[model samples]
Target: MPVGFWVFPWDIEDEGIDRFAARLDELGVTSASPSVLYHSGRALLPRAREHKVRLLGGPGANYPFESLETPLAGMESASAPGTGKRFWQGLAEARSDRGIRLNAWAMPMHGSELGRRLSVAVVRNCFGNPYSYALCPSHPQARRFAESLVGELARSRIFHAIQLESVGYLGYRHFHHHEAEYVGHGPLEELFLSLCFCDACMAGARREGISVVELRESISRDLERRWRDDVWSVGVEDVREALAANDDLQAFISYRQATVASLVSSLAELCHSESTELHCFSAIFPPTLEHSTWIEGTDFAAWSRVLDRLIVFGYTAGGPGAAKVDEGWTRSELEYAGRYFDPSRVNVVLNLAPQYLATLDDARRRFRTISEMGFNDLSITNYGMTSETRLDWVPELGRVLDAPASST
Candidate 1:
């Protein structure tokens, strides 16, 4: 398994490129995924020589782009992707000297700056309220903008591959800063709330002769009634049952998946034309990890046909809702993934922090398990968020990954 790290620009800039690349070498890392575009957040960088805390927002052109021509004009990059000329210069050196394959990572169709643009409708709920964090890919302008970003990243000539994140429909859980939703919406409720009812979605449904108007009304009424109910509990079993029962709802979901798949195909075609590899982090934002990428309109079968590699966060692995993460969890997830994607085309990332792996033994055991499976590529969560102690886990895991058992 070829290993890589999902890194931020700040990580390179703050740590200096030589030191950064050296860390990768020490960790036996062969590839690097650096963010070209990222969401707004304040990150406490542990190893930074300069400022420890960095605030990131907006698009950037650290690598020689002509102009700031996208939807984000005045919004200059606060945590600029590559810190001016020094970053590119250092990155070029790293590539030439280390043979590191650089993956230009970008978050598409999930930016508030792009979503709130005048021409974009963003994603809307059944109640028709806009989700500012999401730019509906079904929107013409948004689709074109996504094409523009991918095209530019592909054409940049600096990357061997381009990784796309949040490339589909985002829902109620795609939260903005300081978010507080007092009302508790269950997993099923959140999924319904996340469903887009924007003009583009409506049009797509209408084209299929779906009674969208009545469907929306039915959804709104049901959600309202549920909120007013004193006791409402929906477990994982309720999700598939509900979808099976509601034909119109199922129709809308199918349309969303088709629309997203179309967008992914076009982007993949664009990347191929530019002679760049395309990989997408196809996992949906959770509360519904059981459905994987399905909940957010990403049809894995459709994606399997197009994407050069589909990256999934196997963060939760078990039965429905990941209710029990037993020893067979990873094997079960791989089997489930085989239904949609070839195991060879999958890149599974392990969140090496305390949040997921939790211990050195757990990390080592999981690494050996996946490596012995021998088909999927493995990527560590990141260089930026991980502490030095956690990063120490990579060298051992990396060695285990390269063993004969994983060479099949």
Candidate 2:
């Protein structure tokens, strides 16, 4: 695997460009992706190039929930993506000279904390109201909004690929506390319920004569009456089977996948017209593991057939169980991911920050395992930590990423 770092650390803003380059050079890193701040600073572009590191497009640090597929000026309100066309143009030219590729990563799911703080809705939870800023695949407006955003980004010369991450709604159904009586009413009640009983949504369902309203009402009543009963204890098995048995729901998911595919495909066609590359980032939910029922509907495997590359964030494998039981947990996860997609077109993001950096020995083990996975490209969680802080292994982790994999 070509190991890489997600270099947008919160602390790097004040650190001078020279200091930053020296740090990467010391770590033996060949390339790094710029953060939103990096793009704004013209001085850092040449410095990164001089260091001979490939720089992917930085993520726009604006409202996370703003549909990248929408036409709202609100989506462009973020600083860099808002007025960074000139920055992108500069980046494109610089990358051409330096041989780096620019890829824009956008979060289409829940909006940023800023969006939540401002939204009137009270969809409260640990991760914020799931409704306020998430892009519900069931909504046409949400889909169109995403499509338009892609079109706008496609016009840029600097960004060659687009990384759509965390695009789907809340995962891990167990975490969805309000699913019982809430039905479609989440924190973003207006947006979430905006089209729940909408004419278009209802009409489409009516075409199948499925009566979505009746089904929803039925479930809502059941949930409300048994709200106190342990749905998990009572319904988990049935819910799982219900999710599996509904071929019709699965078909609906396929249709939604086709809708997303069409939007991305259209954007790709737009990019190809300009001779730019378009790609999508997705994750493979381990079959044995529990995932949100909605994920099966996202139909990403079908999506891979149409998009350029599928970047699987294989962090789940490096999770709690393996870490506690086996030192080689990360490697096993990467290998498992390889089974789903061709290695050449897949980019597995290695978790090298925060969670992985719990201890130096565990960190070293994670790195070694990732290296052996033979991934085409690699990325860390983020560049938020400093050498003095929680990251005692930054130098070692960086060295591991920069070094050639033993197998390679």
Candidate 3:
């Protein structure tokens, strides 16, 4: 299992590169995966290599759904064509470099009308619904756009693998649309709010005989009624005015997960043609959040056959229980994930911040346990997000990286 660190090169300058590379070398860390960015007509891969860190070329955190900004709408005419071109060139350079491996990390179905803010209203109006923030996997245009984008990226020849992310619906889409759907239902009832009710979404669902109008209307009415009843029972009868605001957060998780699976299947086909390896990283929450919806919707089975690797997000900072390193939890999660895809293809991202250097021991243990469970690769969260103190954690991380994977 090869281990690597993640960094943001968008802000990394030549001097900063020297410092970072020095740190990595001192810690005996070799390969590095930095965020993709083109600056001043040049990419950062060369500088990183000068520091002796292998660069993984990528758009960093570019989300496919939100890629369409009005100013940079559409794949062909997307923002800063030169940025991508420079990145491709960087990929070529990295390929020539001794240690780098360039991969396109794509956030597949991550929809956030909230993040788009001003533009979201336009998207909602155009799609004829405010709730349809995520691109409907059932939608042809979404698939076309995704395929075109991947094709264009693959043309660079610098990328050896394609990393898929989010690939699920918005984190809060279900919450925004269907809080009432589960009203009058069991408190613990499972909810996976399904989306894509726009013309495109509905039409796509029709192919499978799923009714868009009925589903939306049902949710709208159910939640509204439940809210009204709950208010009246509490003698807050005047609260009908706020009835429209009621929504279940869990529903968003459900919808997001389903969309992930659909989009992954579609994108996997596109990546395969280019002979590029496909990988996916979780977007919604850390594994401890118990996001089974994401796992099921973006079925690892679909990816295992087509993808070259699978990277699951095991964020610990806000993870349930003790954010502290719990090897038992890490082991269980890795073992569970190992059941889905080849252990070698699976990697766990350990988010480390320099500010959290005090937790280095815990974080290292988490990585060790995960790697021991058969995962070979480890992705450190972000270079930019790390603090000076967090930088202190690098040496300990190097030790964990060098430790042999558990034999069991």
Top candidate on lDDT is 1
lDDT of 3 by residue, 1-408 (tens): 455566544434433444545555564454565433211112223333253333322122331224444432432312222354554455346434545455655543433432242222211211245543344444455555456556655554556766655454433323332244434332111221233345554444455555445655665565456556863222223222232343322333244345556667666777777677667764444532343435235566555665677777655445444445445545666666777777777767766642332476666766666655657777666654455576567676666766765522
TM-score: model 2 vs. ground truth: 0.66
Candidate 1 structure quality by residue, lDDT tens digits, 1-408: 588898887788777788888888888888898877766667776767776777665543334444335555444366774356557656967866987788888877776666655345588889988888788878887787678778877876678888988788887777788888666567678777888888988988999988999998988888888888744446776677778988988888889889999999999999999899899877544325454456788888898899999887656643343322623556666666767777788888777766567677777677777766655488876788888888888888877777767352
Q: List, residue by residue over 1-408, the lDDT tens digit for candidate 2.
A: 244455542223334434554554555444455442122121222223232233322233532233342233333333333333444454455445544455666544334332243233212222232444434544556555455555556565456666665444333331222345443322212111222333433445557655466644544444444435533323245445644765544444444355455556665676677666655555323322333223423445555556676665545544455444333434554565455556677666655433444566666666566555655466654544333443335566656655777632
Q: Stretches of candidate 2 above 4 Å error?
A: 7-13, 16-71, 74-99, 112-130, 170-204, 207-211, 233-239, 244-248, 283-296, 316-322, 325-340, 385-408
User: Clash totals for all models, in order?
Assistant: 0, 15, 11
Q: How many backbone clashes does candidate 1 have?
A: 0
Ranking by lDDT: 1, 3, 2
Write down the lDDT of every candidate, Cα atoms only: 0.75, 0.46, 0.49
Estimate TM-scores for all models: 0.91, 0.66, 0.68
- Model 3 C-alpha lDDT versus the unseen true structure: 0.49
Superposed model 3: Cα runs more than 4 Å off: 13-32, 36-84, 91-96, 111-133, 173-194, 229-262, 287-291, 316-321, 325-329, 354-358, 404-408
Kindly give the stretch of ten consecutive residues in candidate 2 with the minimal lDDT sum. Answer: 37-46
